[model samples]
Target: MDWDKLRIFHSVAEKGSLTHAGDVLHLSQSAVSRQIRALEESLSVTLFHRHARGLILTEQGELLFDATQQMVKRLEATAARIRDSEDGVFGELRVTTTTGFGTLWLAPRLANLYKNYPSLKIDLMLEERVLDLPMREADVAIRMKEPSQADLIRRRLMNIRMRLYASPEYLAEHGTPSTMDEFGNHRLICQQAGAAQVAAGAELVNQLMTHAVASTLTVNNYFGVLQGVLNHLGIGVLPDYIIEDFPHLQRVMPDLESGEVPVFLAYPEELRHSKRVAAFRDFVTDEIFAFRRSRQTE
Candidate 1:
């Protein structure tokens, strides 16, 4: 399929009219229509149907629209990455990080990065959702789990440990569970990263040497989960770095320990050598580890 034709189809789909798409692309309506006609001929399927109101996509067109939208986005992003690679410190960065770190830690330091390099634009997308780098969902990503996808370069940003914590008041009221078996009696909070499959609990159990049951408050947001635990609502597992800031929450059964969670900085393997990417990657890796070790002292 012709890439240019796809671009024309994408514009028409967005604008709902060939004339409007032509205006957006700086082409004539005839040219836009020709591209669409050529595309339909090549695919041997009608992508759009003429309507009195404007253009309506056929069922196949809807599918084509979805795929084309992704294609255009990835192409634009890949181009931006290439353009940014030329200059050591300028251009846009679409970075993705989990909600907790993005809110408490990253959002603050991001200003400093912009201050130091004003030319570089930063789009900080924070969600429990892990963006797909291969699909150009993000230029850089910081995630707790290691990247299992092929053709991605990953770097360990920090080794993070998690512990069970609850507010003092809650512990007093509910009583702290001292052993793994006692966990069954307590209300637990769990964080589920957006519909993506995360590591199984059995892996965590093996790592932490504890058994975990189904949680009562199952939340997808990290900040909300942390707040619930801090408010003495329930016991939840959190990165040690997060709980370190709130002294009110005490570690429940410090001896019932979980192993360290590895935080990673990852991007597509093809783009790792880009100057802008390398700079941000190294900067974050240094800052996060330093932050982690500092919390160890407290």
Candidate 2:
């Protein structure tokens, strides 16, 4: 019930060593051990199993630790909200998105965001895993599909399709394919069928492979696939959004493409008023608009 003791227990459970937890809490090892002992006495339960290597949490400790972790996340979110100023956006803003989009798109455009809010610190998490925005795992997310997560403010950013592309030199050397049958002449570069990717993308690759392509280069992410295409390896199945930034890539078989995948930007409802979140949301929206305009002219 004591907040101080619970805080110490959470640290110890996380670190699995009294000394390590003590160092983090700025307390002596003896002091940390004493606090843990007192907490166990009050709860009348063994929280950890002491071993020569390190402490392991007991079943009860795991439950308590889970609760503490949630509590900490909530507290941190609250603190961040309190620190945000209406007049200026500053402090750490955790943003999550797929590696392909982050590397090929968002990361390159971040200079504009920095120019506007120089004091803002952005922690960009690039992975396929969808982080829990409501649980505070990440402050904002740009996902390939509509987020089914509840209690979040969601915006449809844009729709993207997977299309075939190759370097001009590669097409010139290999001769551009006019149909699915002609695709067999060139090596195909694409994300592996088993890799984590949008279903539409995987489906497009599957369709292409049915043509009995003679050679292939598969990467786990679109970034690698783009690299392979850029180096004149072969025609690659890549997101259409990439073509705007990589104008050197010529679209192959314009009619052959994947179904549209809707991109969404989302944040927890609680973060709707946070200046940091608002700033990021607006920046992404503006970029999307600019991208659309550029594509129209092309």
Candidate 3:
């Protein structure tokens, strides 16, 4: 098949209008329409249903569009890899992780990365949903659990636990809870049961709620929980990783903690030789090491 015609057809199907696709492809509307017609003739299939409003893809068009989309992603990934310098990393790196880790841990430490690779462009996507690494949804991922995706090179970064914490002032005024039974005197701040979170975290919050706490505050993410604790709103259930960054928080009832959650850093196996991915992987590893060292000294 004619690659140029296929490309034009893909663009037209995506935009749902020949004029719009022509605008993007820098081709005249007549030229784009001619390409689409030629492509349909070669394939002997109706690629689109033309209507007064716009073009709608037929079943065959949908299939072709899917193939073209994959082709585009692969080409972009290849281009990024090519743009990366062997001696110095450059180009865009899409890194993804949970909101808590991205905001509290990774994002704050990114200054060092930028300092080392000034040319690097980082797109940090923070969300609870796991992005498809192999499909190029994201270039790298630091996940709370081991990634089960195929064709991924994964390494266990660290283990974290959901632990109870409170501000010094809050503890001083309300008194510390030495045991689970004493939790009744304090407000329990945590992620809501239905919120998108690791199962272990939600389970820990569930366990704490059974203590008959007098008051409660539930936030969707750990960032909000941290805010509530810092403001002395209540005792919060938060990941232990925050302790190094937030030394002012005091661990409440040291014995009450959730099961350990393993943290993993992963990238697609195809990105093994990518300098950008290597730089980011090394940066995160170095940061984790520094974090561990600081905790040891404390």
Candidate whose TM-score is highest: 2
* TM-scores for candidates 1 onward, in order: 0.74, 0.98, 0.96
Which lDDT tens digits does candidate 2 get at residues 1-298?
A: 9999999999999999999999999999999999999999999999999999999999999999999999999999888888874568998999999999999999999999999999999999999999999999999999999999999999999999999999999988999999878999889999987889999999999998878898999999999999999899999999999988999889999999999999999999988789999999999999999999999999
In candidate 1, where is summed lDDT lowest over 10 consecutive residues?
A: 193-202
Model 1: per-residue Cα lDDT over 1-298, one tens digit each = 8878888999999999999999999999999999999999999999999988899999999999999978877777678767865756887778998787777567767766676677887888987677888888888898878988888998887766656778888889988887767766787776653432234422443443345653567566657768888788888766667754576788887875556667788988767677778778867866776786777777
Error of 3 at 167 (Å): 0.4
**205-281: candidate 3 lDDT, tens digit per residue:** 88887778899999999999999999999899999989988998999988888999999999998898999999999
- State, as a TM-score between 0 and 1, how close model 3 is to the true structure: 0.96
Candidate 1 backbone collisions, by pair: none
Question: Candidate 1: RMSD over Cα atoms?
Answer: 4.5
Candidate 2 local distance difference test against the native: 0.95
- Candidate 3 differs from the real structure by a C-alpha RMSD in angstroms, to one decimal, of 1.3
Model 3 off-target regions past 4 Å?
none
Each candidate: how many clashes?
Answer: 0, 0, 0
Ranking by TM-score: 2, 3, 1
Question: RMSD of each candidate?
Answer: 4.5, 0.9, 1.3
